[model samples]
Target: MGRHRNDPRGIAQMVAIGGVIVLFITLVILGGFFLYKSLPSGSDTAAVPEGAAGTTADPQAEEMPTGSLYIRAVGESSEVVVTVPGGDVLADTTLKTDEYLSFTEERTLSVTIGRPSEVEIYVHGERQDVEGEDPGYSFAVQP
Candidate 1:
């Protein structure tokens, strides 16, 4: 056999080509990682316009409501059950005289009162009339 035919040069050349391919792949992956880190995030993309009415740059400003419901037990002790319309009950407990509760809901609420005269209801700081509703009455209120 000739020396050139039996030489190990071909194996060395194959290994060098494989090393170059691996190095090129590693560089491409690292470049993609650095590019991703330099880009702006999704939260920073939207900028609030200037001089817009009722527009706030704060992220929490969009979560608040314009009004809420306020309930108080005034004349005497009473048991109250507050439920969402056709849904689960939010509160089912007793309230003593001068005790107060508040909530914020966008839909109508079904309020069951053990003593209508003892419980007082308010919406957005305005007192609501509960004169005609008798004791053990359940009524619906919206906010």
Candidate 2:
């Protein structure tokens, strides 16, 4: 019987096929990862009740068209002011430690914390870091 090996030709073809497979696998994994990350992490939330702009242990969540933002007071008492760009105060209330308020709106929201060290913000369950050491830590987020 004669050997059926095609010297370098067969080896080159096999190498090329292996390279293609690796490239395909890498792309698939990266594509899937980005797709998963792009999805909205927070589900639909309840709308913040109208005229409840005061102290509340747990304010109702807002059902905005854009996305979700979770703000929690981690101090004995924290003052939070959430407002829209056009002078509409979404929620102006004091949150007790461990209390949180959720806001989800299509428009941008500006959050001002009287005591920055006593608040925690979350987007899709990821904690956010606000840049301010003095009181009245302020930041704007679009959700």
Best by TM-score: 2
Tell me how far the alpha carbon of residue 138 in candidate 1 is from the true structure, in angstroms, after superposition. Answer: 2.1
Q: Give lDDT tens digits, candidate 1, residues 1-143.
A: 55574469977887899999999999999999999998867452222233322222232233322345555666757787777767666676676655555566677777788887887776655777875788888777677
State the C-alpha lDDT per candidate: 0.64, 0.69
lDDT score of model 2?
0.69
Give the top-scoring candidate (lDDT).
2
Worst 10 residues of 2 by lDDT: 57-66
Name model 1 segments beyond 4 Å from true: 1-67
TM-score of each candidate structure, all chains considered together: 0.48, 0.52
Model 1, poorest ten-residue lDDT window?
Answer: 46-55
| Candidate 2's TM-score | 0.52
lDDT of 2 by residue, 19-77 (tens): 99999999999999999998866643223446744322343433322235677766677
